[model samples]
Target chain A: MQYTSPIREPLVLQGKTYADVTEDICRQVEAAPNPRWLGAMFLSLLALGWGSYTLYRTWWYGIGEWGLNKTVGWAWDITNFVWWVGIGHAGTLISAILLLFRQKWRTSINRAAEAMTIFAVLCAGSFILMHMGRPWLAHWALPLPNTYGSLWVNFNSPLVWDVFAISTYLTVSIVFWYMGLIPDLATIRERAKNPIARFIYGAMSFAWNGSAKTWARYEMVALVLAGLSTPLVLSVHTIVSFDFATSVIPGWHTTIFPPYFVAGAIFSGFAMVLTLMLITRHVYKLQAYITLEHIESMNKIILLTGSIVGIAYLTEFFIAWYSGVEYESYCFINRAFGPYWWAYWSMMTCNVISPQFFWFRSMRRNIYVTFALSIVVNIGMWFERFVIIVTSLHRDYVPSSWTMFWPTYVDVGDYIFSFGFFFTCFFLFAKFLPVINIAEVKAILKSSSAPSVIEKEEKVKAGVKLTPSYNPKSE
Target chain B: MTKHEETHKFLVGIFNDEDILIGAIKKLQAAGVKLHDAYTPYPVHHLDEYLGFKRSRLSKAAFLFGATGAILAATFQSYVMGIDWPMIIGGKDFIAPPSFVPVTFEFAVLCASLGMVATFLVSNGLLPWKKAVMFDPRSTDDKFVLAINLADNKKIEEAKIVELLKANGAEEVNTKEIKKK
Candidate 1:
């Protein structure tokens, strides 16, 4: 018989049967778009239009259209790049790390989170191209055989490492996400009455039969991918950190960047997940699947990661002063008291102080508080990147050359474009795909459903007790 | 090549629950009846062991693919940077293995993930255009299905097999003929 801990909160509520799981998830995919979805899509398209126009002007007039000056060359572009890339981390962590740990709650959220990873990575990648000014020559980033005067991409460069890391991360994430979607796609294909829908889902599903032998191999593939992805996810951000840490700049150069960046990435990522999931839970009416317990578990992670980030912040300050490096010490002091002090303080307040509220269990579990804090945390994360990129570059060793950076319209528009792009992709995915893994949720139903619901079920089917004895503590 | 069609016959048993299905499999095996295959909406743990299937070797495949990627990356970087056109930048050595670690690790993971998934899909006969031989479509929905091939179990009478399925809590017993390519 299946056994779950007595004190453990149920991951799935209302004791949903396998059929009910299928029906509830599939109903959203099969139904036509609701007014809310359409309205959101329209707003996203409008932002995308404005972003596209600004992107065109920037490309046409060259990088001069951006607010970047000689003093602060890498301003909003790199900040957004780092922020979005950091947001992409939560999906793989949810799918790969949580799966390896055998967290059944991941089944409800992994699909959407992984989808977010793919889209967020896409948004992050666009910045790399946008910053290049001439995106058409993007092929030069690849280590192709020297066609231009016998010069190859420097393998030693951290920028070169980013190309490999980001591309590999995106490809593997898509393969992993699509592999998980096949079985659910087959379920949708079977239920679709329209021939067009049937053919589309059927082809996408690759005719999965769900045979015991196939499932065995499928599970094996999933496990191995998860194993590979765990290290890959960590490595991707580490390489991104290397881009800054390898530089000789006082504020940017630090040994603590890799771990600090990773912790911050997960912190921001879980916040973004909470932001999207809270809305998704409401819109799709998936409260039974994504319960408060799931939110609490994610909040606990945010609390842990946020504290780690806070500690990292203090450690950076301590090292700067303790090492007796005047440049490094001055960098830290200037960040807090300089012209960009508002941005730095905002980062500290939003990222460092805001998440501390989650220390209280009630705040962690409250939906409205969680939702507001999630957005606050993301705003803090964005400023964290801005503070790191802008504050460091705005004032360097040459005091005469140091100047404050201001954003042009293109910078703001380009940022809005990513929102438009991300939400557009997410809305389409939610409408067409099963936002939750139907099969995985079904697999956990017998073991993780609420005990009280099961007891009620047992009473309805008298003399047929799924669990031999119902423990009162399960309530 | 000309297309060829094949017809296969089987006794399909429909089960409402996975627990009852597992129990039925054990009982049917004790009756000395050879089974074809079982299908379910979700994974049924230990069902493979009850069916006496061997452990999957996809992990080994992943390891081999990963090794190939590491070797390929190390060799390619060494050949290009050390021998082909070495340029000393930032006063670093011509051959730096430490710098190669990030790309090598990333490529290894990339190769392993893509290769293993390809192996899985190919081995399982899952392709976008491939036609599926389904005993019952409900197996992909909410039902558990167990099929016993008539040709594989020639000694067992059809009537006796049907009776065994019913006695072991199968909700329905039916015959299905599947066309295979």
Candidate 2:
């Protein structure tokens, strides 16, 4: 198993000190165009206000405002929920799971992805909470001791599972995100000049002297948490899948659900990572950090997962047709050519066909091309949930039960409102926290005193004699 | 020797190798000289234990602060929403558990985060306004330092300590004497 160590070819020669880099980052943010402020105002005022209006009407008018009725008891709301939840998955995958694998490339982008994870989850949860036409008393689903009016919440319920799954995932991700920030906080602490800056940074540094011992512990703890999160992340979305798999719906009850849902989630999530990153790179002026190499790597993942999800979609169809189950076949066919047929094909073309471009190295590396593809991936994923929910529910077994689900203004409004909630949180995170983990980036560029064979050989080739050279006693 | 002992002195040596610096520190520790403090641009493994530092008690304080926060949050919730107003929905019981989960969970997390933050500040004695040493900016990048405070006594044995630090791994050794500004 002997191998040569790479010669000290000067990895990232003339590396910037973390402090300088951080200050530069802060200055860049400070000096950036007022577009962020203006963007925030515009997105919030229009989207947030509209969303609030939709929510207000939903609360006042009840479930009637949505396209849901007896036939399609669950319509666009559930579709939106599943879609957003999948979209949230990419963040955890990039941050927690990738960290566990020790993928060095993830360091550059994980911060933003993790932040997006938190915000995306918030948005997803809002859709669900609002879906509860009675948004006020949404707690009846918890195992609280309520001695009156159906107080006993069934812990066994998948709905209960959803509550635990989403909440725990969110909590762990936030903690992981914050823990990762500590060293960067220390970096910021050192640069503080104003009293307020010093106070704030010093407080957050937690007496971190950057001692070797503390660093060891920090790395160990972070690794352990990453380990915990990797499986927890996989399980969280799988459990979310259980919310559907456990249901008695003909098309939804397939054995291939957990993996299918998980794949879809990652597919959507990576798309989201790309979307947010494209905007962030331009705004932050981080050409060096968020390089094309990174986008290409991510695009590869999107392609891999996109194909996986496409296969899942196809597998479901094959299974239905193979089993000769009329109801299931009808559901599958209706999805591709039903009232929501447009949404279905859109999902297929964008998600399945679009990522096919990444099979080429050139296309994958093209940032603009990937950015466009990632957006299409998101739209397709959104339609995936729509096709799954609307098509299946619209034309169930009973002919009289067949109906169309057209979202009222309230339903559409709530959709927009959730985006408002999402963007506002994101805008704030971008402002405060280092969007890229400053400390981690520095750790990646490291050197050791002991020269490897190649470095020694290179030095020898360069006729650079070692001063006071002494042979190794054993050698 | 007495004249040198009486002088506020420091032995400074510079080495580029970490192993030599570490070996020197170990030799000094073995010889029973106290290491006051050390600094590096980035963390070095085992530096704290080598210097005989204790584990941070920040976690314990955070737990205590978090407990206090949880209690207060619960009390406030019970008093205001549980008992005082008792707003029941969907024939829900007055003491519904589900309704309290969000608030209670929020309180626990909020408390833990805030407690850790405050304890982190207070334990470190990190006041906002202080002009401490900016002695060597290199301490923040690609340089290592060992500082022995001469607050209690004149640095008589500094030569031996400096020699050992240089032998073990120290790139540079320096000292500071508190002077009236």
Candidate 3:
């Protein structure tokens, strides 16, 4: 057996064996939903309903029902769209980038983060559909052959790039997430007691046999997908930033937007992961699998990315002034001191200032503080998008066209609607799927040897049978 | 009976610990035992190398698929923009390859990923409706089961194989007759 310093912390606490890992995860799926899960689901469904109702109203009344005007054309919809897309970055970062880096700490949280990526992208995609106004004509974004004499989508438009980018990101993420779930799904299929459960889980499992050859191929496929996804995730947010940077708007016209947006994306993505994971670990009582060490490690990432984002914010300001472009300088000045100064300042406080608290060990370890700051970070990111979009567009060089934009009820409703959509999917995902990746967790058990494994080893030495007695009663 | 209709008997050795399983696989291989297959709850890092399995061809397949996707993306965009409807926007040429890049990149990734996963599934015979040869349910949960097909060779008795397994620290030994489907 591999020996290390006794003081070193294990990734999985409580000395769990391979069997216990399977049991712990399968037990979550096999057992009936507890009151807490039911409560969260109930609340999520209610919000989903409310959001759907609001969206229906928007559909009924048309785009005029929104707070949008000629001047501030893109407001909360685009902000929320960008924000959701950015939130998805953490999942890809955890699952793909960290996989390539061979970071073991990621194994505990990658499953949930990947799921969050899919759901967040779903939310982000829906906003674009709604933002298009004539959702029926949304097919125009695709490069499909048209009835009107060979008309094609604008190849030069970043918006068209977004259509391809978002769809491709969503597809590859689903495939990656589903591929990772196969072995665990097979495990669930075998453990399932109910016939219905067996059928569903079995189909989802794709009849995985856990053979050595299959495992080898599975790893190869996973590695290849991860390789594909790393560049794909970076390009996704870069394309998203292109939506703004390609525009003639002074503040939006910057070369640094791509890397800045990417960094901010990872920052907000990690923050969202922390927010969800903290609650998930608490709610599911999975402290043994998702230890404080995991939380601390994630916090360190947040601090790093958050600082990069802060520097980006400062760089944008310096460049705006350094370029000696009057309109650009004025745009930055107006953002910090003009009509929407509050939004700009909130973005700074949340994205730049709040995450710095993670520099201290106590702040990183404090769950409540981390949770609160995560929400603050998300709030800041939303405002960051808002400050970039509305503030830049709300006041233009033509002072006659300048006007302060405010969100109508529908605007607020749409934001809530997207959150409801996000949460509904998340709640369902949490309940149905193994929130933790069981197979990956099993692989790490040797290193993260829970105390129980040590005790079980002792029992085996004392002549206790190694094969766990099969319980037909449970079956 | 024809080979297709014949049922194969497998001498299965179940191991709780991975270390013991690896040792047994090495010992069995050294003893000139022709192994059928090994099943585990999770992927063992160097098990395949120890068992003398060939390296996977999935990466080569991924590269070909990715190249196809990239070519398709570039060709499709070029045809649409340059020939079909050549309306100029942003004062750029209709066949501006720079603008085609994002779509091309996305398509390449999408194709490469989906193709590789599909290849993996098909290669493993793990389609949704396919039947898996389940050696033991515990293999998916906790046990590492090493199965040797008795039908393939008649040189060794079942008892001798069982003894070999037990002596090498197998938690349990059993005979299971698996049908060739």
Candidate 4:
């Protein structure tokens, strides 16, 4: 007999049947694009068009289009890179980490979140390519043999580590996401009335028949992938932190960088997930699946990670003073009181102070409050990266070369390009695929469905009769 | 019945509820019936064991692939940095093992996940163009399907098996003929 604790809230709320789960999730994919979706897609395409022009200028005219001096060389580009990469973390964390922990709420959000992870990583990677200036010689970062001696890529360099980490992270995430999509895609395939839809979904689904043997292997694969991804996700941001931590720069050099960056990544990632999911849940009418409980659960995570980030901020200040290094101490003081003090304060207020509002139960559950804070937290996160990259570089040991970094239109436009790219990909995914995982939801339906629904289903099962019907032509 | 004759014949039982399906499988198994396989829209817990399937070896394959990746990464890095044109850029030694850890970990995870998933898809005969041998299309939606091949159950009559399926709460019992490729 299936049993669940009475105290535990149902993950799949409302009286939803197995068939209803398929119908509800598949409705969006089967239907034509709504007006709201069309409008959003149009705006995204416009931004993308503008951003593409800036990207063209950056590529054609080179990094000179970006406002970069010798001292403040890596400004908006690296900051956006780190920001988008951080946002990518929430999807894998939700899909892999939460799956290992058996958080049932992850079921409703993992599909969309994984898609977000892929898109965000692509956006992050574009920054790296753009920052390379030549873009054509991007393959030089790889360890391929060339005529310039037999020199290989330095594995010791954290930048090189980033190449492996980011690529592996992206590849593994896509594989995991696609594996999960097979069963759901098969569901869509079986339900599709249009021959085009059927053939496309059928081909994508790899003709998955949902056999017992296949399900057993599928579960095993998911479990092993989760186990592998757990550490892989942690290692990704840690390697990203190494890009700064290994440097001799005062603010950039910190042993606490790994854990701090990881926490901040999750914090920002959760905020991004909320930003997308809140809008998605509303647009697609998926309130029954992506319930308030999922939002609140995600908020609790944001609160926890935000607090850790807040502590890391304080810890950095303490270490700077305690180290008794004049350069380090001056760096912290300059960040707080120097020319770019506004950026520092914005980071502190948004990343540290704003998430504390989730301490209250009402605030966590309030849709408008959560939505507003989600946007605020992301803005705060962007500021956090900006403060780290620009402030630290703008004022270093050499007072003669001290300079303030300013973003040109190209810098701003390139950032807007990522936004356009992320949203366009997301809107298309939301249109074409099942946003929520259908098979996993149905799997949990029996145990997690409401007690009333279970009773009703049980009664129906008892009264059901044998009705053998043959339809060979249906195949 | 001949092997060719029995290969095409199957006794198909459709179930709405998983509990009834599991119960029917138990009753069918206790009567010494040779069950072919069962299908469900979602994975039913312990159904593999009830159907007499061994635990999957995919985890072992993952470990093997992961180890291969780690060894390959370490060897390649060491061969390149230590032996192949070693140039000391920083003050660090020519062979730094600690620096190799990040790449090694990433490569291992990449190999393990990709390799395991590839193994799973290949083993399950899942491909983009492969025609799915579905006993009931509803098996991918809401139905629980229990399929028994007649070749493996020659001792039991087909009508008796159908009756047993009906008695055990199968919502629908039907005969399925598998067309030869």
Output the number of the TM-score-best candidate. 1
lDDT for residue A107 in candidate 1, whole number 0-100:
94
Worst 10 residues of 4 chain A by lDDT: A466-475
Off by over 4 Å in 2: A1-19, A28-37, A149-151, A447-475, B1-156, B159-181
Model 4 Cα lDDT, one tens digit per residue, A129-176: 999999999999998989988779998999999999999999998998
Model 1: per-residue Cα lDDT over A1-475, one tens digit each: 4578967878887767778899999999999898999999999999999999999987898788899999899998999999999999999999999999999889999999999999999999999999999999899999887656667889999999999999999999999999999999999988989999999998999989899988888999999999999999999899999999999988899999999999999999999999999999999999888988899999999999999999998999999999999999998998889888898898899889999998998888899999999999999999989988888888889999989899999999999999999999999999999999999988888788864444655676796645423243422
- Provide the TM-score for each candidate, comma-separated: 0.97, 0.76, 0.96, 0.96
DockQ, every prediction: 0.82, 0.12, 0.77, 0.79
Per-residue lDDT of candidate 2, residues B57-166 (tens digit): 55565567657865775565556455555665556666656545544544454455455654554544433443334334444444455655444225446566666666
Docking class of 4: medium
The numbered model that scores best in DockQ is 1
Q: How well is candidate 2 docked (DockQ)?
A: 0.12
Candidate 3, residues A288-407, lDDT tens digits: the string is 788777888998988998899999999999999999999999999999999999999999999989989999988887888889999999999999999999999999889999998888
Between candidates 2 and 3, the one scoring higher on DockQ is 3
True contacts kept of each: 0.84, 0.10, 0.86, 0.89
lDDT of each: 0.91, 0.68, 0.87, 0.91
Candidate 3 Cα deviation (angstroms), residue A274: 1.3
Off by over 4 Å in 4: A458-475, B1-7
Model 3 alpha-carbon miss at residue B80, Å: 1.4
Write candidate 3's Cα lDDT for B38-125 as tens digits. 9999888877777778999999999999999999999999999998889778889989999999999999988888888888888788
Count clashes in each candidate, considering only residues at least 3 apart in sequence or on different chains.
0, 14, 5, 0
lDDT of 4 by residue, B54-129 (tens): 9999999999999999999999999989999787868777789999999998999989988999888998989998
